[model samples]
Structure formats: C-alpha cells, structure tokens
Target: MANQGPKSQTILVVGGGIAGVTAAIEAAETGYDVILLERGPALGGRVAQLNRYFPKLCHPTCGLEINFQRIRKLKNLRVVTMASVAGVKGEKGDYTVSVSVSPRYVNANCTACGACAEATDMEVDSPFNYGLSKTKAAYLPHEHAFPMRYVVAPSAIGTPEADKIKAACKYDAVDLEDKGEDFEVNCGAVIWATGWEPYDPEKLESYNYNLSADIVSNVQMERLANHDGPTGGKIVRPSNGEPVKKVAMIQCAGSRDLNHLPYCSRICCLGSLKHAVYVREQYEDAQVDIYYIDLRAHDKLEAFYQRVAADPQVNFVKSKPASIRIDEEGRPVLCGENTITRELYEAPYDLVVLATGMKPAASEGYVPDIAMEQDEYGFLVPSVEGDGGIIPAGVASGPLDVSMSVQSATAAALKAIQAVGPKS
Candidate 1:
C-alpha cells in the first residue's frame, strides 16, 4: 500500500491574540510554515485592551511588542488580519480550512500617517476601548495595533466622507472599493485560540449596570486605569468625570451562579485585587471595599491576596451583593446580605466595579463546523485521544491568564509540529 500522510506541513492558527501569536511564532521559529488569522483589524486581542496584569502588574504592550517583533522577523509566518475561519474539513495531518476576510479599506501602502484620520469628520465608537470613547471613521485600531494600519469604517463607505478619506491619503493606501475576499488553505493541523469575551453585565439585571454610568465592569476598570483609555488614566466616575472616593469591587458578578456561567472564571478575584491597587495608586484617601461570596485566590496567588488584604484602606467583605439600586441623588447603592455579620446592608459608593467573568469567544456562534468539541460552558475541549488534528489553546480551551495562555500556545505549537512533521 502507498503511504498516505500529510500533503502539507503548514499549520494554521486561528485568532491573533497572545495565544495565537505565541503559537505562530513558536512554530515558525521551529522551521514550520504558519498562517495566523485574526477577526479584528489587528493582531492583538483582549490582551491589548488591558492596562496591566496581576502579580507583576507589568504593562501588556511591552510583552506584545516583543512578540510583534519576533513575528516581523519570521519569514515562515504570515499574518492575516480581519480574517476568520469559515469552515474546516478532512482529518489529522491533512485538513482544508476555509477563511473569510473583512475589508480594512486601507492596504499595505499605509505608512501609519494621520492624514486619513484628519480627512474624516465622522466618528465611531472605538471597540478597542470597549466603546468608552470614539475614534475617527478613518482610524487606526489602537496605539499598539500590529501592522499599524488605519481602517475605514463600513459606515463611511459610499459616503462623501469616504471620498475625503481616500483623497487625503498621500500613499493611495485607501481603497474605497476594496471588498474583502474568502479563500482556503490546505494545512496539516489547526490551533484554536479565539480567546474570550467579558460576560455582559447588562444581563445581571439586579446589578443595574445600565442604570448608572458610575457602575462599570471589571474590563472597563482596566481601561479606566489605562493611559490610552477614555479618561486618560484617571480613575473617575464615568457619569460626571469626578475622581472616585469610595469604590466597591463586586466579585463573581456573572460567574458561579446558576442563572449565569455557573463556573468560577478563576481570574475575577485577582483582577479585583489588582483593581484595588489601581485605585489606591491613584487616590491615597480612597476607601475600596471588596464584596465576594468567597475569595478564591488559590495556590501561588495567595501571596498577592495577602498583600492586598494588608492595605488598611482596602476592606474585604464576606457577602454577595443581591442588587444595585440608585439613590435620589443618582448614586449607586449596593444592597445585599453580609454573610459574616448575618445582617442586611445597603451601602452607597461613588463607583462600583463588577468583576464580570470571562465567556469563551466560541460561544458567540462563529466557530466553523469542525471536529472540535465544546464543553457546556462553550470552551473548546482538546481531543483526549491526542490525535493532534484540531488543538485548543489559551482561553478557547478554558479560562486562563496571560502567562498560562502563552504556555498553552507553546504546547499547541509543539503538538501541531509533531502532527505534521515527517513520520518514519
């Protein structure tokens, strides 16, 4: 019998977040052809939106920049932004993947020049900031956007503003008629690293997320502390632009509840703790209160929990907030039972940060019809048989922090390489 093996050794990585980026780089550096796809206009995913991570509290962009540099230097790797997986077919070591690309309207001719932005008077809510701010219709994705190209919003298409944007570009980078294209690639293995999204706080009706702009989600808190964010790094009330004096961080806002995720997201506790640090660093007199069903700072993170607990200004309350109400003065008031004291309490704060948990991006329903299996929570599950056909990495496999996501990506890369490598 003739040998039937992988026709191509190329590996395809879907989702250009830290996980996808790491897998692509690791595989390409190991001398394998890799293609990285991102659904957005750029490569960086949720990690790019963060102010800083826990423990070290180090800036995310610094690490992303290094990875970006590695990507730029690797000739065996190709990055396709504004692209998504449409479908997948075939078996391990031999697969055909279909991809759909969205038009950026701006092409490789772009020089990161601000001329295109200066031309458009129309604006759109910036998704990078999670709609906390607006950007020009012809705008770059973010400050650290990989490829560093501008994008023309679809709303600007066929409008006079689009013409103005096209005319303003000196490099002819703007292509007003550029409709995106769909294509297929034959590869040996696939790595799924689509990452995650923040749980919608609006669904937590009792939290009254829409009742007051002063109430924000944990992801918004990250932007509130980011220098590139809406308030320019000021931890202020979104309603009136005033500094927050009294702050409340509610843990497990949408997780570990039968009505919601019903699983511990594992990052909420530490995230809220880091948020406490951001508040204290900005305002010394600020008093921050954390309310949780229970603190789950498991394993190595206990030290961080202990350090934050030591702060005299940061108080830990043993309770789960039942609802949030607005006062006559339009302030957000927390109403709930204090489990420790076994007493009902209502407390008003200048701002409330809901520690909303992570929801797998695959849950949004864009995943291709493939052999992968998703848990009830919507996280992709790797094959237990270790066929190495379709691998799940990073947050797509489960809820994981940045460091762990990288580790997951590395493992996925190795599995993909092994699956595609020449067999004896």
Candidate 2:
C-alpha cells in the first residue's frame, strides 16, 4: 500500500466516541471521504451512558442525536460499528490499516423489534450500567444507541439461546452464523479520537470499594442517578435499597498521588460537584460532604462552584481522606486530617462516592500499540509542529470535559483536512 505515491483522500477515524464522531462529521462535511470505526456494538460511547453533563446538567442524548443526524446527512461519511484497528503499516499520507470486526449477530434487516430480547432468558453484566445490573443475552446497548441495533453475547453463540433468539425474530435479522472478519482500509490521514476510561476504584486500597456495598465510583453514581438505571433514578443504598439522605463525595480518589495517577485528572473536581447536585436535587433534606485538596473549578466553572456552595445542606471540607472503614453500625467512616482546621476527622455517612480520574483509552487496550507521543499522564497529545498524519483528539490527547473535547475534535479535524488537502 506504500509505494511512496500520492496519498488517497480518505481519512480514517479509529473510535466512535464523542471525539471520533465530531472529528469524522467535521472532516466529511468539509468534503473529505471519511470512515469511522467503533470497537463497541454501537456508537455514542461513554456519552450515551451519562445521566447528565456537568455545568449545564443537560441530558447527553440531545447532543448525540444531533451529531448522529449530521452524520446521516453526510454521504461522505461511512460508519462501521464493532470494528477496531488491529495494525497500521506505512507512513504519513500513505497508510494501510488492518481492521478487525466482531459480529453483532443482528443484521440491517432488523427493525429493532423486541422479539429476540423476549426469547432470551440468559443474562450478562451490563457494561452500559458499569456492571451495576444484568441484561438479556440478546439486547440493545441502550435506548439511544446510534445504529439502534441489538447484539448477542459471545457466550450465546452455540447455545440453545441462540436458536431461540433467531427463531423469535420475525424479520429474520438474527444471524447466528455470522462470523467476524478482518479487512483493510487505505487512508491518507488517521484521527485518534479514542477517549478515556474511569480509573479503576478497586486499586485504591484505602477506600475499601468492594468491602462496602454503598461505596461506589463517580461513574457508577451517574448510573444510580439515571432514570434507566437499576435503581430507577433513586439514589439508594445498593446494600438495602434504602434512600440515601447523607453522602460523602471524595475528590481526587486515586489521583494526584505518586502511588496512583500522580496528576490531576482535571475532570474529577467538576464531576464530584455535579454528583453533589444530583443528590441535593433529589432529596430536600439530603446532606452532602465534599472532601478535596482544592476545588479546581477554573474560569467559567468557578461560578457553578459558588452556586452549589450556596446550598446550606452541601458542605465542603478540605482534606484528602486517609481511609474508609465500615463501622459496627454498617456506615462508611471516613478518616482524614482536615488541612484547614488542622484537625483529624472521623465521619460516617449512608453512602461514599470516590471521584476517580480518567485513564486514556489508548493507555487501555484500544490501540495500545499506536506509535503516538503521550504526555506524562498517558494522554496522546500532538506536538506543536503536529504528528505527520495521525491526529489525537478529545481525552485521547488529554483529560478534558465534554465541551473541551468537542473543541479539540474540531481542531483535529482541521489538521486532518489540511493533511489530506482538498478534492482534486
């Protein structure tokens, strides 16, 4: 694929998250042929699973749907779901990407009818809910999946459940015999919009994440507050299903410590603050305690900090928690030294939430072998002069919130467009 020849005008984006979606749409609408590949069964990525965004507190569906519509209208853009880039060969404008695709087990003829779901009794952990609940073996990723198609877990491939699911489909969209395949796509430039994942809370040995049923991560807190979530939008204790009236929000959990990430995630402070709002808005008498080294609510976000602080029920404490212990009363007791008062505090609450940081998607399994430059925090940042043909966008470049990610994606689109040049 590399003859040192003039490169093709095709641009390939190897992620279908917000960043990938924005970059693809911008480049394609600007008149370049673009291909978007998602490793998951559907598009929308982490944004699809969010209850509401910070700052504005708006549902993520509206923004995602608008992007989906824009993509549908652009004939230059082609979306391929359940596909990932396995390898890359050549350099700059001349590159060949090896793409491996997984089977969805459901075909385009699918009307998204509920027949297959009704036929399956087998269930698996729902990744959409951060594994807080289980889902049918044959189920849609979520109500607002971009392609609106269903997927079958690999465990059901040769089981009787597979045959039952296929038989129940009236449109014959279920294809139990569909085998995954690997293919190649040649493109001039590649945009790495692969986003980040929540840092694993289990690694924070001091927090006791698994020891207490009510101690959860910030991402899980989003699900618990979601109407479609397992608890049906009520912030309740998973242990006894009791309403949560008093809560502790621990900021910088597993972040800014040499033992862990060692740098500020940049999003945790705002995310934890948003969690506090969700709790306050739900219950009139609910009390929220926020523990943090400092509130990094910079610029426009500082106003929001003041707005939340005005609430009498929400109290801010300056401290990095030393440890969490489930007392004899079954409450999570937080132990720490308050830097402000120079006092050691031991407080207990109905629920404990650890605001974990973001770990780059590239740092994880997604394109783990990509030869891109990363910052000290494992973000794929482009140099001032820029990488030749591979552009990094969104959290893939660095830790950023949704709005900042969109702006980064737009910048990446501009770079990719410049690399590929105009239609000849």
Candidate 3:
C-alpha cells in the first residue's frame, strides 16, 4: 500500500483574492512549490471592486501592485486563472485534487492591447463594476489585472462579433474554439481562501430596493464613487443623471436581523462611514444622514468614526428604518422609529445607500464537498484536532477587513507549511 503521508511538498492555494494571493506568496517564498487558482478570468477578487480602504482610505491597487511584482519574481509560484476545485481524494499530505478550468477564450498570446475590445460593438454588463456599467464583449478584467489578459464574454460566443474580435487581434490570441478542460493537481496541503460576497439588497423587501433605482446597495455605492465606475466617480441618482444633494446611508441593511445575517458583518459600519466621506468630499452642499441600530467601530477604527462624525453636515440617527416608500413625485421616503428618542420620524432623500453585509462564498455553494467542515454561518472551520491538510484563510474563515484577511492568510501559510514539512 502507498503511504498516506507527506508524499509531496506542493501547496494548492484556492481563490485568487488578496488572501489566497498572500498565502501563495508566503508559502512559495518559504521554498514550497505553490499552485494558485482563481475562478475568474483574472486575479483580484472583491478587493479589485472597491474604491478605497477605510480609515486611511488608500487605494487598494497600491498593495496589489506590490504583490503582483513579487509574484513575477517568484519562480516556484504558478498562477492559474478561471479554475476551481472539483473534488479531493486521499488523506492529508497525500491528496489528489480534481480541478476545473473554464474557457477564457483569450489565450496567453493576449497582449491586452485593447484591439479586440475596439473591434466589437457588442456590450455586456461589466461584472467588475458589479453590473453598474457596461463593457465591450472583449475587454480586460480591470485596469490592474495581474495577468493583464482580456476575456471574451460567453454572451459574444456563436455570434458574428466573435469572428470580428478574433480577426482584430494582431497576435491571433483569440481562440473561438477553445473549450475548457478538467485536470488534477497532486499536493500535500490546500489553502481555501475563497472570500465573501455582498449580501443581496433585493432580499430586504421593505427597503423597496427593486422598485427604485435610487436605492443602491453598499457595494454598488463603491462602484458609484469609483472613477472608473458608471458615473465617472460622480455620486448621482441612478434613476436619472441628477446630482445627489441629500443622501441616506442605512447601516446593517441586510445584517444583524433575525431574517437576514444574524451576526455583525464587522465592516459595514466602517464602510458606510467611508461612503459618507465620499459624498461629503464630492458635493459641498450634500447632507448625509446615517441611520444605524448601533455603531460597531472598535479599537484603532474608532478614530475614523470620530473624524466622520465631526462633520456637521453628517447626521447620525440611532434608529432601524422600518421601510422605504416612494412618493408620487418618485422621491424615496424613510419611515422608522427612533429607539433613543422614542419617536417616529419620516424623511426623504435623493439617494438611499443600503449598507449590506458579507455572505461567505461557501454559503453560495461555491465550496467543494471536501472533508473540510463549516460553521453554522457557512464559513469554513478548521478541524479542532488539526487532523487535515486543508486550511481556511481570509473571509473563508470569517468576516474580516483587508488587514485582518492578510493576517489570517499569513497564519494559514505557516500552518500549511507545517502540515507538509518533515514530521517531528
């Protein structure tokens, strides 16, 4: 019989977000061969969609660029995009993992020269922008994509536009007949870093999210504030191209309720605070009202809350809004009782931003049916006795900010290395 023990020192890092990328880098730098897989056409998951981080509010690209540079210099690390784990067989330190690779239709010959995008007039909702904007059928994932490769949308396949896109590429990089294939990776350890997704605002029935275009989710608000977003960094009424003077930011839109996410998302409060800053910086006369059940800012982040609270134009209401109703004039009105004041209040706003929470990717059926366990919230949980080589990192383990996710990834890397290292 073959020994079911540390036969290979290779580590497989799943998901290409900041957490997975960090784990791959840390493990590879420690002399372990690492295979990093991303389910999208390019790397940079949810972090790539954000406008900026909280508190310091620095651009996310700054850190991602440094990681990208490190990846280019590392010879032991290999990155495979448009791939996901299908299954796993065998025990810890001697596992064979089945993998599925989706067709990007654009091959390695891609120079990202923007020729294909220009050749096709077909447009599709851009997933990078959370569908807030439209992109050409043949387009790059984002400006800072690590591989810097373009993707041909499945919607464009089987159409005459596909031929145009292929013919326009000078290097003949577009592969119209390219079909995805499945393979297997032999590794001693696995790191699951699949991140979180925004809680759907449409689930909040009383919010009237579907009835009005002015009611936007927290993630959508990020895109709206982004320079490459649909509105060109201008916060406006999505119903019409009018500037927003009065904005209502609702905290815990789909979180901390019996019907929705029962636990605090940890980042919604800070995100909403950052959104307030985005509005206050753009429009001089903008009045921002922040409605919340309670603020969850703690530790070093308390100072950022204080800074935004100091703005006289920003108002904080200690209330959980009951519902949003549109008036005959098409204005959104908020109705709720103030827990502190014990009085009912009704207010109107040009735009309502719902601060949605994070839902683990595992909850959405993205995780494979492996030996790994999950908590009640569907976040991956490590075995109590440390019996397996599969480890969870970043938001895959729990809800965390960018800084916390990096810390989790670093710890996971150490654990993975120990799993495949020489047994003491």
Better-scoring candidate (lDDT), 1 or 3? 1
Please identify model 1 stretches exceeding 4 Å from their true place.
1-6, 384-386
Candidate that beats the other on TM-score, 2 or 3, i.e. the better one: 3
lDDT of 3: 0.90
Candidate of highest lDDT: 1
- Candidate 2 global Cα RMSD: 2.2
Q: What is the overall TM-score of model 2 with all chains considered together? A: 0.96
- Candidate 3 lDDT, 1-424, residue by residue in tens: 1223348778899999999999999998987889999999887799888899998999998899999999999998999999998887766778788999989999999999999999999999999888878999999999889799999999899999999999999998999998988998888889999999899898999998988889999999999999988899899999998999999999988889879998889999999999999999999999999999899897999999999999999999999899999988788999999888899988989999999999999787456445478888889987665566899999999999999999999999998998888532
Residue ranges of candidate 2 with Cα displaced over 4 Å: 1-6, 366-371, 383-387
lDDT of 2 by residue, 48-138 (tens): 8889998999999899999999998988899999998888876667678899999989999888887898998999999999999999999
The order of the candidates by TM-score, greatest first, is 1, 3, 2
Write the residue-wise lDDT of candidate 1 on 15-105 in tens digits. Answer: 9999999999999898888999999999879999999999889999999999999999998899999999888888777888889898899
All candidates: TM-score: 0.97, 0.96, 0.97
Order of candidate numbers by lDDT, starting with the best: 1, 3, 2
